[model samples]
Target: MSARAALATALDRIERYDEDIGALLEVDAAGAAARAAELDRSESHGALHGMPFVVKANMCIEGRIASCGSRMLEGYRAPYTASAVQRLIDEGAVPIGIANMDEFAFGSSGENSSFGSTRNPWDLSRAPGGSSSGSAAAVAARMVPFALGSDTGGSVRQPAALCGVTGYKPTYGVVSRHGLIAFGSSLDAVGVLATSAADVERVLAVISGADERDATSALRAPFEPAPARTDLRGLRVGLPREYFPADLDGRVRQPLEQALDDLRRLGAELVELDLPTTRHAIAAYYVVATAEASSNLARYDGVRYGARIAGDGSLQGMFAATRGAAFGAEALRRILLGTYVLSSGYYDAWYLRALKVRRAILRDFQAAFERVDVLAAPTSPTPAFRLGEKLSDPLAMYLCDVLTVPTSLAGLPAISVPCGCAAEDGVELPVGLQLIGPAFEDARVLSVARCYQAATEHHRRLPPLVAGGVA
Candidate 1:
């Protein structure tokens, strides 16, 4: 199909289905169509030639509004595109628009977005997960072929799992963060959500590698295409005992166990392993992530960036007014907690201690790597939950990410692929199976996910919303 045709088709779907789902925060329809037309006239198409995609609101795109799904940046226009995004453009991917996200990438559910929560495509009453909520929902809804989201903690993977699509979080330094608005600098990663692992891999190859702009970006080998196989052969898969606890929902537990059986039948060895420090990951991740968030978010004074609110009296007054008015409740809660931990008297006690815990978690993962090629686990404790189910309880909402946060804290690469389905409220919701690899082992992780996808039709299964409307 011509680039313009593809762009047109995606735009039409968004117009038809997005009103109920709220997957996009902004739609650059004219820009995308114009670019698609131009690409159609090109003599040679790049790797992604004419494919349409979406970017999370937090990532910058020159001349486009990068709202980060908050009132603070609601009117802000980006002066430059993110390096990762620019690279994709060079390969012929046309950005459709900015997908919604938790304000400043904070909450575990999409409810934290100032623009409103993104509903799960499977069931509009349920959350799609966050802070990559909109990106995951858009892809799952087939509003776009794929989308980019930043994963800090379980922002990307959790949503992808909940949305029943493939979400790939690259190694910490593998993708540059020059344009992603900082939430947890140390834990943040630019990730991709798409219908299949191969599509994620295609985008990953284009966006991966070093950038002089981002000091933390690594000089890694660019992605190369390869043949995939379903046979596991000599691969050893580790099941972290802590990830499958007794408290896990029965719906989620059953599908994941069956997936293990599938892998076993395909010639993979499943070994149970213990990552003793897993219990402490949530506490430590919150401290370290919030501490960095508190520091990074300090720049949003009305005078410097974002929307400004006139002060009643002084400069400090203006600062407080702007942030207080612009930031959502969840964002403020995290900021307050982060500031408290980083406070003078509490820094050593809370921040420093969390760092120690982080180190221990990393070491635990490193030790596990010595024995297993990849570690597998449920992506979330349950499938998509009702939108308001955990919104009123922040602690309960945070616990939703329990299964995916440890690898995130360790800066490891992880991919979430649909393993099976669970019936919730009489609707069959998708359950994700996550495969985590050691740092920078993104390729291996994607390979395993692609192999599973090839062997099963899970990833090919579309949500009722998309499937019903598409034909």
Candidate 2:
């Protein structure tokens, strides 16, 4: 498709489905048309020519609102484009709009957005999984070929699992975080959501590289794509016993087992192993994530950019009033948790220990990679739960990410690919099979997902809404 044609199709999809899905917070139809026109007239093109995509709200796009899905930064325009995004633009991928996200990229359910929750396309009553909810839903609904999202913990992978699309979180330093608004500086990873693993690989090729603007960006040569895998022969796929406990939901386990069988049939050798630190991942993730969040979110105290309420004509009161008015309930909860962890006499007990646990998690992966090419597991413990199901229970909501957090904490490369569907009261929901690789094995992770998708039709299944079976 021509660039303009691609954007037209995306806009049409957004118009037909976004109102019901709540996937997009804003649509840049006119700007995208202009960029598409420029692409059509240009004689030269980059790898992603004619591609249409969206940026998660937390990522900057010059002149666009980088709201981070919170009222505090609502209407706050981005002054400069993010380094990763600019690279895509350079390669001719057009950005159609900003995708919705949890407030400050804080929540897993996407319900924390001040803008409103993004409904899952498969079932409007269900969450698409989040803070990257909109990105995953948009791709699932065919509104865009792919989109960007920031993954802290299981944000990107979890949503992609719930939404039935491919989501990839590259190694920590693979993508520059220069334009991404932070939740957890150490754990946050800019990721991608797409209709297929191959599409995701194409997008990542353009965005992954060294960036002088981001100190954390790895000083490395341009990304070299992994050779395509025709079969899984000689590939050892490790199954960590910790990832599959006796309590795993039957619906999730069934579909994942089918996928594992498919992998085995494709000639992959399944080896069982142990990652003893798996149970501590959630506790360590929250402590490390929230502590970093507290420090990163401190900039929005009504003194800097974002919402402000001048209260009682005093600076302290103004700070309190502004934060009180702008931050969402979940955002406030995390901030408090983060602050308490970083408080005097508590930092060593909480934050420091979490860091130590993070290293242990990394070591666990390193040891596993010594014996296997990749690790296979479920992305989320269950299929997409109904919206508001876990909202009232913070711990329950946090536990939903149990399976995916370990990879995030370890700063490894991982991808969630649609394995099959699980049924809930006769309604079908997508389940994801997560593939993880050691640090910097991003290409291998993507390659494995692509190979699996090549054999099975699971990733080909469409949501009811997208298939026109539902209103």
Candidate 3:
């Protein structure tokens, strides 16, 4: 289909179905049409020729409102596009809109988004896990064929799992971070959310090179696609004993075990691995992420960009008012926690210790990778929960990331693909199995994901809104 036609279809779906899903924070139907028209006649179409996609609200797209789903930047417009977004546009992909996310990408559940939560299209009352909530939901709803998301922790992978889509987070520094509004700089990575592994691989191919603009960008590496077949004759898949806790629901465990069985049948050698430091990953992740957030977010002081408070008699007053009014309760909570962790005397005790723990976690992954080609675990302990189910308890929200955080800390590549569904309350919630690869081994991660996806039709199931309609 032509780019214009694809965009029209996306816009029609947005108009017809977005109201109930809340997947989009902004939809530029006209803008997208114009871009598609421009690409339609280009002599040399790039990899994403005339493709339409959504970007997480946090990533800047020139002239568009780049609200990070927070009151602070509710009406903020981007002065320039993020390098990742720009790369997509250059490749002939048109940005259809910006999707909702957890405020400042701080929450694990979509409910934390100040614009309102993005509903899991599978079950409206359930969350489309966040802070890549809208990115995952939009793809699941078929509002767009693919979308861009950022992962500081499990922001992209967790949501992709819950929404039954493919979410791939590249190794840190593999993708340019020049325009991604910071959450945890060291851990953050630009990710892609799409319907299949091939789509992800295509998008990543175009945007995965070094950029002088981003000092952290990795040196360019040749794009080599993983072998298409899943004859993992010599591939060793590691299963960490810690990932399956006693408290794990049977609905989640059964499908996960079945997925492992399928891998075994496909000739993957299953090896039991121990990541003892996994117990401290959640606490360590929070401490490290918030500390980095404290530093990265300090720039939004009303003096430069974003929402500014009016009628300030002094500079301090302006800064205080702007942040006070712009930031939401959750963002404020993170800022406070971040500031406290990085504060003068406490930095050594809290922030420094977290760094030590982070190193330990990385070491654990390094050790395990020596014995296995890839590590497998349940992406999330349970499937999507009701919208407000865990919002009241911050720790509970943090716990949802247990299986995904260790990989983030290790700066390894990971992909989450739906394995099956969990039967609970007479309903089946999606279950995602996560595959973690060594640093710069994104191809392997994608390869394993595609293998599993081909072996099962789990990822092929569409959410109700896309398969049928809102009942």
For candidate 3, the 10 contiguous residues with the lowest summed lDDT are: 462-471
lDDT digits (tens) for residues 57-81 of candidate 1: 9999998879888899888889999
Q: What tens digits encode model 2's per-residue C-alpha lDDT throughout 1-471?
A: 799989988898899899999989999899999999999999998899989999999999999989999999989999999999999999999999999988998778889899999999988999989999999999999899899998889899999999999999999989999999988888889999998899888988899999999999988866667888899999999999999899899999999999999999999999999999999999999999889998999899898688999988799999989988899888898899999999999999999999999999999999999999999999999888889999999999899889888998989999999999988887889999999998888888888899999999887788877787322
**For model 1, what is the C-alpha lDDT against the true structure?**
0.90
Candidate 1 ranges with C-alpha deviation above 4 Å:
225-227
The 0-to-1 C-alpha lDDT of every candidate, in the order given, reads: 0.90, 0.91, 0.88
- For candidate 3, the TM-score is 0.97
Per-residue lDDT, model 1, residue 212, is 91
Assess the local accuracy of residue 388 in candidate 1 as a C-alpha lDDT between 0 and 100.
92
After superposing candidate 2 on the true structure, give the runs of residues whose Cα lies further than 4 Å from its correct spot. 468-471
Q: Candidate 1: give its CA RMSD in angstroms.
A: 1.1
